[model samples]
Target: MKKILFIYFAIISLVLPQSQNESGYAFLKNGFTARNIAMGEFGAVGINDLSALHYNPSYLALNNKTQLAFSHHSLFNDYSSENFGFSFNLFNLPFAIGINTTKIDGIELRTKPGELIAKFNANYFYASLSSAYQIKNFYFGATIKYLYENIYIDDSNGYAFDFGFNYEKFYDNFSLGVVIKNIGNVNELKNIKTKLPLDFQIGINYNYKYDDFEFNPIIGYQNYLTDKISHLHFGTEIKYSQTVSLRLGYVSNYDSKNITTGLGVVFKKFNIDYAYVPIKYGLGDNHILTLIYNF
Candidate 1:
């Protein structure tokens, strides 16, 4: 089993982006689902079908069905990102996997003062495999990530690990989770001498149930360890009946565009999600659309 996993990971490494350089800014913008990004990237509880691989691996164990999700994002219609994720419970042991890519396409690497020198593309890709196991009131999980990147005359590649734990009371409305990412540099290549972008995060999710309606809120603190950038984020999912849902979120330090609005639907095994986020610094707004299926 371990060898198979290694082979699978090797294949993933071949296609991913190495987000390492003299400075590690590319690691900061590596992609994930926009639903999470809209919430200022606060994804700790992350029980959502698609984000299990990135945020909380324990969510895979809680689900018995298989899930697949894809997203399209427009960052002001110029630079954009595309993502895909899949997760399933295999052999009664939960497993999850994901793939994401960010392409800064349509930008000309200009000379001084807006003169076009040459066309360039800086892309980063991440592929991950994760698993979770249940133990009493807690679930412990881990993820292995493969990264790859190629830029103008410079290329680097590496691997990292993530660990997560979640605890929930059976009859309570509260849950907690903690996750740590970027554990080791399993395969460090040349010219990339820095450690991976590391992060530690804590999350809280609550659902207040009532006769007519229920409100679900999620709050989290994320600390990027290597950079010392700390942030707080929160979101609420308000639902009416079994059909329609609304979402809003806030994050303190991501940008001026902190608020988020989202719409959701559940129709048997099919789900559709949409999020609209306003601008922080640019002239255009951003939107993300996602579709998911669980079976």
Candidate 2:
């Protein structure tokens, strides 16, 4: 049974997304909202919603309204997550809070290949507080996060920090953003320490509008410092009358899958978004949905 458990853990370490089989806390690298996922997870720039708290907090300063958001992720291999976010202004500064919980149930525990001994569930969670400040057209932001994970009888906890900057004065309708993420440490689990997935990203986006129609195109580069891996992200969004949207995105340099698509609808102060991603190797597909309310 011990040997089987070890093998299971090794496989999990190799298969989680965006980590390149190099880091722990895979949930941290996953997208926090459906809109961002549908847009190739390109949140390093050109995002003004509460989802910014998970990517580039600098973007949070662009909105003046109080907002609340909730998201659900149905990922491959029985993995699922629920997320919550709240964004508001206090003391003339934009601040946001976010929480994520992930679970994998009915994992088989067996001593050998023949029979099952039992079953267990894995759990992961994180809570974060983020804030941003703006000077002229430049924005700077920071986030503090608390992370926890449990699998079988092993559990660990950690803390991390993220910093980001954005410049919106490039050309008309153009913006640039940069971010550094996962700068912190975690305690050991079962006498073995797990490394964080440190990352750096930069991106540019253009917002074009004519009458009641809008188009946004974005491209970005991401580097996983801990794993020495890199990837490219690109996406576009089309909107009509600010009420309906279509989004398409592509990611490069991944082993499993690359294309993503989604939709959005807005009515008064409420908005909903959905995203779809197809995974290779029969790992199943990913579906994400999010709802937001503004006050």
Candidate 3:
């Protein structure tokens, strides 16, 4: 019995990953997008008009006026999250500023001695300040983030950066965007040094609008520098009557990914959107609800 206990302790000590400088436990995709993880981080091609800061800061540049949005997600049976953002323009300037945050609502934590400690309340909390500048059809922006998290006994705090650009030309029916995220790391864990979940993404969107119908198609790729994970996603959105919208999307990379579908409705200056993510496995099925007030 003593031999078995010693062996177990040895294994747990190595696997506990109590230091930030360690390499195995890695900072991963702990962000706030239900569609992002389910649809392969493909939100750079958003079908709705809220909280585009997840994929590209430049996407929020379209807010000609102040806009605020909130989203809630049931990430599984026990884990959940909430996302909120607000963006606005200034006078006739070509600059914009936005605030974005994602909070991990509930995570249970227990002591290593097998005693139940306290719940994490939030396993991860991230707040970002984003800004953009546009010249003609070209827009560029970036985000600075503050992160705080406590996972079990291993805690890490870090800063991350994101930069992105969007451009369109010719008939203005085609668009392309590029975004790079999490290129820096300043982990305040047990004094070890590591990196963020560095990534690069490029996307294209095209659409046609008429009196009665609007159709949009989007494609994007994300390359994760940490683990060299590259993924592709494709999606389309359709709108009719100018009040209702539907979305369909696909992702490539995993053995099986979710089929993303969503519904949206507009009433005067307010927009309500809901996304259904058909994810099984550890994530289970997820439903996201969003509210946006546009001015």
Model 1 scores a TM of 0.83
- Regions more than 4 Å wrong, model 3: 1-41, 45-50, 91-122, 170-172
- Name the runs in model 2 displaced over 4 angstroms: 1-21
Ranking by lDDT: 2, 1, 3
Q: Which candidate wins on TM-score? A: 2
The all-Cα superposition gives candidate 1 an RMSD in Å to the true structure of 8.1
What clash pairs does model 3 have? 21-192, 21-193
Q: How displaced is residue 210 in candidate 1, in Å?
A: 1.8
Order candidates by TM-score, high to low.
Answer: 2, 1, 3
1-295: candidate 2 lDDT, tens digit per residue: 1224434555354323334347778778899888889998778998868998999998888765589999999988688999999999899999999999998777776656777777777899999999999899999999999989887788889999999999995888899999999999988766566778898999999999999999999999999887788999999999999999999999999999899999999989998999999999888799999999988
TM-scores for all predictions: 0.83, 0.94, 0.79
TM-score of 3: 0.79
Worst 10 residues of 3 by lDDT: 1-10
Give residue 192's error in model 3 in angstroms. 4.5
For candidate 3, write residues 1-295 as lDDT tens digits: 0111222234234323444433322323533443343333475544235455666777666544577777787655555667777766566532333333333433434435555445434355677777767788887778887766654455667678889888864347888878888766656444445456677888888878888888877888877766577888787777888788787777777654547777678899977777776775655666777778887
Each model's lDDT: 0.69, 0.86, 0.62
For model 1, residues 127-194, the per-residue Cα lDDT tens digits are 88999888877888889988766543455667878888888754487888888887666343333354
Candidate 2 matches the true fold with a TM-score of 0.94
